[model samples]
Target: MLLFISYVILLLVDGTKTDETNTETDLALDKPASSSSHIIHPPQAVNDGNTGTTWGSNSCFAVQLADYDPWWQMDLQVKVKVTKVKVTARSECCPERLHDFSIDVYQEQPSNSAPKVCYFYSGSVSNPGETVTVTCSRPVTGRFVRISGKNKLNPEDVLQMCDVQVFGVAISTHFDSCASLVQYKQQHSTKTPLKTISEGIDNTAACAAACERSESCTGFSIRHLPATVCELLQGEISPSLQADVTWDSYVYQGCFSVCE
Candidate 1:
């Protein structure tokens, strides 16, 4: 595969450090695998015969009320400190349009009775080859999540989910979830204060999913923008657990990291 070099920029909220390493392994986008907490509903099961989106080598499954059974759930084994999560989509020609689809994040739970949804990402009307990103502002621990939705094309009704993600330091892994986001900005703002570079979902549930999917994404952010755009920035991150940078709508954990 040929990798084109693009300028990589890191913006900080305060006294935070960004990673200089570059990796392109989007393992978070790999085919869904059944875990103790999650599973994917096969294609045939959803649309009699099929429903899927293919862009180059990346294939996203269609989410419909029918077959889109798998939740892609996992166990939030430990408390994670995270920031943002970016969900990137590939270019693909489609026979239909995907719509109302949502990426739901949850706190670690034993059943769906108490499962909480982070928020639904309003996908683009024309998602030929664009990146639909979201961010979270805190560190949350959850196990089961559901990436569900459907497409609304003229002739064919389909649902599509290309990539799911989460960000944070896993209790089972060796990562860092340091101070709150506000403090990091206070001390480092001179160097890296919280500047709105991008955005994402309303809270941290989406960010958690992005972090979990990414192999190197240490953190992620879900910033709200012009009523139409949500930015999900990732890389080396800091947990935004400060007092001032708090949210009540969803899990607001200030997380930061590489764009995993």
Candidate 2:
């Protein structure tokens, strides 16, 4: 009986190890929740799970605006660690139109904030029949992904994409409401009245929450009492700005997990 029980336990352990190894490959393809700034074919065609090349006949195709800086954007809806972006090229025509393109991933829209560049292809794709996979140097976390580049052959900037497939795992970023921004200091520890500080902020929780969700905010300052208020700063607290001790300030640690 003891020998049989031991053998069963060994089998279970091996089974668990096999499951763990397959988790990443089994991850579902993250389809775009929504798409914008596309022309001709709807952006949904890219991730519609169809990779056929019958453009105009088959609805799964995407084309962007011909104007300069034209781009295609997709909302992943939730933060994900994007491992790779696979783009299926159009075989019907104009394959060279997609030359010099970039794939950008962002927590916020690229227009509002700087995006992390995942992969860039400067020349024309080597193969029009095969899927072109752009693997990020490291997995990036973001809710939105944008593919933008110039159409070197055309007079205007344009891009042609099909079957836009994204592969990755979901992740969450941490923001402590009770914790004060660590890098900030009180602007006036001795003289500035809390009422004179700003208005609307009441506690560290509210102040921290506001800055935590903002991609542009790097640190913040708050005051207490009659008119509790908070002021958000764009970047890290600079030495010149840190000299002011009138308001309470804290800096974000800016921690996030990346792909190995």
Q: Score every model by TM-score.
A: 0.40, 0.53
Q: lDDT tens digits, residues 1-260, model 1?
A: 21221221232222112356743222133222332221144422221222233533334544433443324343333333333444434356642244454544455453543544455556454666454555553333443444554334333444544444555443312122331221122111111322232345444455444443433333333433333222233333333333223221112233333222
lDDT of 2 by residue, 13-79 (tens): 1111125457433122344534445565676767666677657745444454445665677776546
Best by lDDT: 2
**Model 2 segments more than 4 A misplaced:** 1-37, 60-65, 172-260
Sequence-dependent TM-score of model 2:
0.53
- What's the true lDDT of residue 62 in model 2? 45
lDDT, candidate 1, at 163? 47
Best by TM-score: 2
The local distance difference test score of each candidate is: 0.37, 0.57
